[model samples]
Target: MTIPGHDQSSYRLRLEWGPTGADAVRADYAVVVDVLSFTTTLSVAVERGIEVFPFRWRDARAAEHAMRHAATLAVGRFEALSRGDARHVSLSPASLAEVEGVERLVLPSPNGSSIAFALADAGSSVVGACLRNAAAVARWLAPRVADGASVVVVPAGERWYDDTLRPAAEDLWGAGAVLDALLHGLGVDAAASPEARLAIAAWRAADLPGDLLDCAGGRELSGAGFVADVEIAGQHDVSEVVPVLVGESFRDAATLPPDGPRLRRVGA
Candidate 1:
């Protein structure tokens, strides 16, 4: 299973889309991406006190229905906000929180939700890796590979390109950096090369406070008004909560406090 134009020996990094890609994910590791902020936003919201329920972008009505009856906060975006849409809020976690009396969050985004549904059953652990959680996810994944486990780093690519989304280039690059660090024993400084350096320079020029917002995804997120979420997600080695998909929903594997925020139990 060697993907052309990528390193074939170390591990496989494949870019795919549509139903064919979605079908293939059932037997491989799937890292869903929607770097502009849906995945990042979901990670942040779940880290906070909010619960997330992801659905197909076309299933907006179902998400809205869930929000109305289940106290869920419907979060989505296409172009504009619809009128009299009480349950649906902007994809921003901050904006979603502004709505009064909402509980769980139902999210439908252009890329993230589609990727999630596609890769729902590929990896032993379907983890969401973004630039925000790059280091953390890399650290978490490093030890696992020592067991000779097969891993696939799936980037949620744009609808048009097989390459991962530009905003998600950080994750793809970061994943490669992590693998290089683990296998070839490279340090973070060594990891920061042409692209990484350019990313850092961009971050500094933008007056961004941290390295999280420096990536392609971070810039898109900044425009989307979820810059804070990107900052929080970008923090390295913070929460141990690596959300893994079980059946159809995600569960936090990190040993957080009992009262800590978490996603809804798939069965409970």
Candidate 2:
């Protein structure tokens, strides 16, 4: 199903927002962006060699899912803290960076994670993208796109008080960061749609670090005392890990065999 006039299907590279927008674009690969947290944390997890399971909600189902996978379930900012559980890792990238001995984790985030699930459900090869790993992700995609594959970068925006999409600035910048890396940074020959061009422009014209901290999502995280995570998001191209969703988990794509195939299932 495609949205008339909105789906950037005319171009090999496209950019959109959230799950609905992902459906509209419908590309071979989908890059999910959530700068303030989800993708940022995902990069850190993959960098640490931890498999991450993206769940849509942090509810009873998430806990059960984690148990079924024999993975640790991540809780909200203060939920695990209040419960006095030692494994207190939230969506914050900082929290995940400090964690140890965890091989697998279930990250339940409705916005970014939900969009990732939607894209995966639609059978697109999904990868989480943020400023930290944008260059690496772009490098991976460059060869594939040059070989005639298509891609859509989806910025998972935040929700408003009324539950509507807020089109958060941080997410836009994150998407733009990926686009910038692909087009100008890596010089990928993939033709970009207008939506994609907009993203590239946003990234090229931004002030960085300062712009990210002043964004709405940054302020929100800062107000919630997770300013460190926002600071982490402000960074650009510091990681080579690209977390690709294979089956149900996001694993480091760089670790796979040449040409990227089969995340090993030897444990089972």
Candidate 3:
């Protein structure tokens, strides 16, 4: 139910691995990182004024969820090419570059999407993050973290063929990117857990934009003709948009009213 003895509760900034870790170290806020795509695509979508709904799967439920919101349901990367529509959206951040005439979209994946959905379901104010907007996310959180908001950053790692977590380095870098900005950027000096410090180190160790191209996840996507997506995900701090989950959809934090209500776990 919670971390055995590695509780990071006292720290204002924290880091965790997946859904279970998220629930274990549940805080007043959560940051979901999935740089190979999910959050990268989310950055693109939110920048375009599109509302994104995170779904745990890309099956029938996604279709129904999309329909219920009058939104388009994203298809698989390869499936999008076959859709014959130039605007067909997929998990590929590159594919969403030219999307138009759409407002709401159901974006789903087994990793980050599931994590974001679950964290929100558990009543944590969730923010979708990737390498591209790490600094901006950190800047947004700095003031709040200064005001006593505890954050649990979740790096949604990939799953292996046997369904075990792969602990992908890219996601660690993604989370580290945010933690690094928060610690070194605005002079907030929020208390960071040992786990969060590790992430910050990983972010510094990364070579960025170039190192990601050769990372395992990058090679996998490049080999599959989705290299552009990897490239987009690799760009650091290039976006000013911060996608915060409002109710069930991710909206640009800047666009919402300053006094908007925040979701909080019942007894957390």
List the RMSD of every prediction in angstroms.
7.5, 4.1, 1.5
Q: Per-residue alpha-carbon lDDT of model 2 for 44-63, expressed as tens digits? A: 98899999999886467888
lDDT of 1: 0.49
lDDT of 1 by residue, 1-268 (tens): 2234332223333333333443443223445544455656666655665556666676647655464647464545433334435455656645543555544666666666656755563323466655455556555545544433334455454444663433444444434433443434423222223322443333334332354477655676677655765665454434444555555555554643543233232213
Best-first order by lDDT: 3, 2, 1
TM-score of each: 0.60, 0.93, 0.95
Leading candidate by TM-score: 3
Which of the two candidates, 2 or 3, achieves a greater lDDT against the reference? 3
Over 4 Å off, model 1: 1-28, 64-73, 77-89, 96-103, 121-124, 160-168, 171-238, 255-268
Candidate 3 has its poorest 10 consecutive residues by lDDT at: 259-268
Off by over 4 Å in 2: 81-86, 261-268
Higher-TM-score candidate of 1 and 2: 2
On the 0 to 100 scale, the lDDT of residue 237 in model 3 is: 90
Using TM-score as the measure, what is the rank order of every candidate, best first? 3, 2, 1
Top lDDT prediction, candidate number: 3
Clash statistics: count for each candidate: 3, 0, 0
